[model samples]
Target: MTEASMRFEEGEGFARRMDAEDPLRSFREEFLFPQSPQGEPLVYLAGNSLGLQPRRAQQYVQEEMEDWARLGVEGHFHARRPWLPYHENLTGQTARLVGALPLEVVVMNTLSVNLHLMMVSFYRPTRERFKILIEGGAFPSDQYAVASQARFHGFDPKDAVLKLEPRAGEDTLRTEDILETLERHGSEIALVLLGNVNYLTGQAFDMKALTQAAHARGCRVGFDLAHGAGNLRLSLHDDGPDFAVWCSYKYLNGGPGALGGVFIHERHARAEGLPRFEGWWGNDKAIRFQMGPDFVPLPGAEGWQLSNPPIFQLAALRASMELFDRATMPSLRGKGDRLTGYLEFLLDRLPSGFVRITTPRDVKARGSQLSLRFSKDPRRLLTRLSEAGVCCDFRSPDIIRAAPAPLYNSFQDVYRFVKVLESHARD
Candidate 1:
């Protein structure tokens, strides 16, 4: 058989062989994989966008629905895993995923909302030193949030929000450039807010080094962990940021529109006089049901909560967190690194200009996603790949994102993805 024909005939069996060897292969059964009308699984490589739902999520949510139907108001206290303290149960797992202490992390509102709340406390800007620095090409949600916040304070975002862009012709930002920007503007910057991983380029920033540098300049630091939460292991406590926020729907496998999570370092736990966006849920936990006029905030990250937990959303998160707890981040990250590296290796073997990896090649510089920038518009290739049953995502202009999630993706998935790419290139 010719090489191309052999690849097609042997690809599925080869991939199944790799799946058999995958340490995390068992985890794949935990999620509800998308199937064709005939019930066969589709090759899923879009975990970086919306993860497959955990099979246990329906059962978890069903329990809540039954409790609400049977117990009504009493469900808050009488149900198994009482609704009153439900959010607390997932803290330890969430902390483990993000490399922070249980007390430092909390599940609350969505990503953008948590960011605004974090800024209420962390973004304390003054007349001379009021600028905030962020990585260039950050998610539009973040850019809008920062711009609106700056405008709210009478600071022009054009001036108050300084973006650290890569040098001309470079796809990813360099650490040296980031640090240099800090060094030059550190004195005037109040807070350094950056994404732990860049969304489009899949570049994972050096959090520990960057946070430490920002602190030395007396600037508060925070992170938007939308891309890093499940894709990479973060030492959030050790890195010591003022706060961080992330969404659970991506690599966490919490389904679409999952609730967001937040982390606040323990050092700020008992801060008596910090500004916050207040609500009843953020009041003293002990006195929360007392229904009085006092405004006592809960300690640590929980203090940022402004409303009651969304039990249905929390149920989905809880189911996913259980799976995460069973498999730690280190093991997951290890698998992801190898799987993505394999994808990179195969892509590099292709002809020059046919495909160029926009995501950094260095293992330390990226997470599971390998962004491919085709020499021409990539949408045609994306549509072709989709029709062929290889699932990935396309960003505007020319980038296509493919991720190999350790939780559900198998080695064969990577193998087949390459197989499809080879076919697409020739077409």
Candidate 2:
């Protein structure tokens, strides 16, 4: 059916029909869904926060653990999937997920750590072009990271960090305003660092346009793709962003606090003296064990690795990346668009004046999440919904964020969640 003819009827029948027709419906069975007291799967719409664990996750971790116990030291090379090159296995899949070449991507430290490392290389500043431009209300961790980087470079956060804010009475930032800001201050701005998908508003920025505009003004650019990496179809390399960093836990389904992925555009891959913090793992694999005094860095993003990663974390991530490889990002994204559109259709029809969606109306401008702004406290409403077996999450004073993740969520799940919210609005 055409999107315009996709009229949503007021019943479970339409939802069921949509699910029955979905091509990716079987993918839901691959995950371990959490259940309420009645042993039924709750309407899980919080994959934006923590994805449901993949069924194969435990098995993958156990293989590594068993190898560690049996072979001990020899496991580094003798394990079922040898530990020395375990992270290398994830490089290609992760690169595919973020739309970059394998050489430009690497699985490494947590999100913020990678952000700081990227900043070390991309955020180089001079006395004139040292200002950092970023979106206002960025994730707190990113704000902290930018500020600390500025301070470490002998600049005050107040003077060095430039935050782009929304206009009064606006819920989200406008693209034109972003470009204008880049154009207006491009000469003095040393770096442009913004969240590709804003966590609070679910806004997906036009990274290509932003990157091109920044490059035009001689400013280096990067992105925090925490919410964009798996949630949206990205071309991090082709889009010409200098660097990008993201966590795999949210949309990548890599379990809580999983390893993050980084992209250092191939343009910076060489040994042409790019300044970065290095350790043993960042050294060239050929001479890494020789314990030489010289630090011979590896090519591309691997040169940024500080130490070997935690094995269990990589194992949990491997299980999910394998699933993504089979399902494919384009297919998952197709489903995500329809699933979120269904949620938006239902929410728009509600008679309640108590809340409004803060997420953008244009589907292309957002991701899988829909952020709702309530006139009153949304926490109580969220609590009541949870009691009724819903699993969406509440953010701060009034926003409730629901994400109908394409990999596992179904149309029926969206219907059930809205039904609960409609009931609360009536009360």
Candidate 3:
């Protein structure tokens, strides 16, 4: 293309035009963006880290506050969206977002906590085959939770945790290499836990193939959907993993520290009794108030709950889930690919080694986030990006993660981010 045509294609005006034509453009008004001290939008793009708060989040929280003031404890049953069946309202929508039946999903505790709870029931380890196989660069919280679970089960983490690192001198793990490791260690691996989309590099693993391979080896499998829940197209039920866990605080837009969700395959929901860490909430809903010592576990994913649900967090989550219901994951995934591709195109136009995209280039192999590795000091580039109001995330050592969430982020956001990044590179 001629210089004139190239300039026309990448100009700020072009970004504005793209935003104008965007189907999700109206959704941007739904979020409460962070502001500078001067009170302007901070150009927020870190939705993969923690999504922007939905405007309705305050109303959801206030509804509970009002209920507490008016109905007191009776609000559990009397409040609008009664706290008694509050989680039920979210279950169907949450399941739909991840492409599962209502019976397969539950919205409850925080992410790491839910992972441990699921492990309690699913990670049934024996003396001969008791190790957990996981990706090498897992989120620290996940590593900590898995290690703690191993210790809780009387196994040493150093011996029971089998980490799969990338091949030498590579940033991302190859799919073949991961499958080979699973095949080689299949017999001894009691559980195979991995991230659907890696938090750092944005590499999305193929869940269906991986789950099938793990199951063939007689190993239980689970996924941390923290980065993939709303950012990628996931059919949890069809994928057929033993279990999964994710936090709504990220792509689900449920505000900071929002309630996390868990999924249990339908097969296990009715299978002969299994061991689980239980609480009164896990008891049968019909006789929960009967206060019997006998714990009759509910039939599905709800059977895993361990305590009274967090009403306030659930409220915010409900608000966010409603938004996700209106915007489905498949549609979001389509836009995510284009936005990230635009980012890659822009980054590629820069001078050699100014920035390198560590995230996989295959659209099918990544979510919305792109990890930018800088030739200059990463911290310095981070400061420059911040000063320019292009909000993003930084992983230690050297990576900037910018996620353009289709729910609220526009193509214009991606264009602006690249403009700032290119300017910084030149500086």
TM-score leader: 2
Candidate rank order under lDDT = 2, 1, 3
**How would you order the candidates by TM-score, starting with the best?**
2, 3, 1
**Weakest 10 consecutive residues, lDDT, candidate 1?**
1-10
Question: What lDDT, from 0 to 1, does candidate 2 have?
Answer: 0.90
Q: Which runs of model 1 end up more than 4 angstroms from their true locations?
A: 1-17, 36-39
Candidate 2's residue-wise lDDT over 176-223, tens digit each?
Answer: 999999889998899999999999999999999999999999999999
RMSD list, candidates in order: 3.9, 1.2, 2.9
Cα error of candidate 1 at position 197, Å: 0.6
Off by over 4 Å in 2: 1-5
Query: What lDDT does model 1 reach?
Result: 0.87
Model 3 residue 227 CA deviation in Å: 0.7
Instruction: Estimate the TM-score for candidate 2.
Output: 0.98
What lDDT does candidate 2 reach at residue 135?
A: 83
**How many pairs of residues in model 1 come into backbone collision?**
1
Cα displacement (angstroms), candidate 2, residue 59, comes to 0.5
lDDT of candidate 3? 0.86
lDDT (Cα, 0-100) at 409 in candidate 1: 87
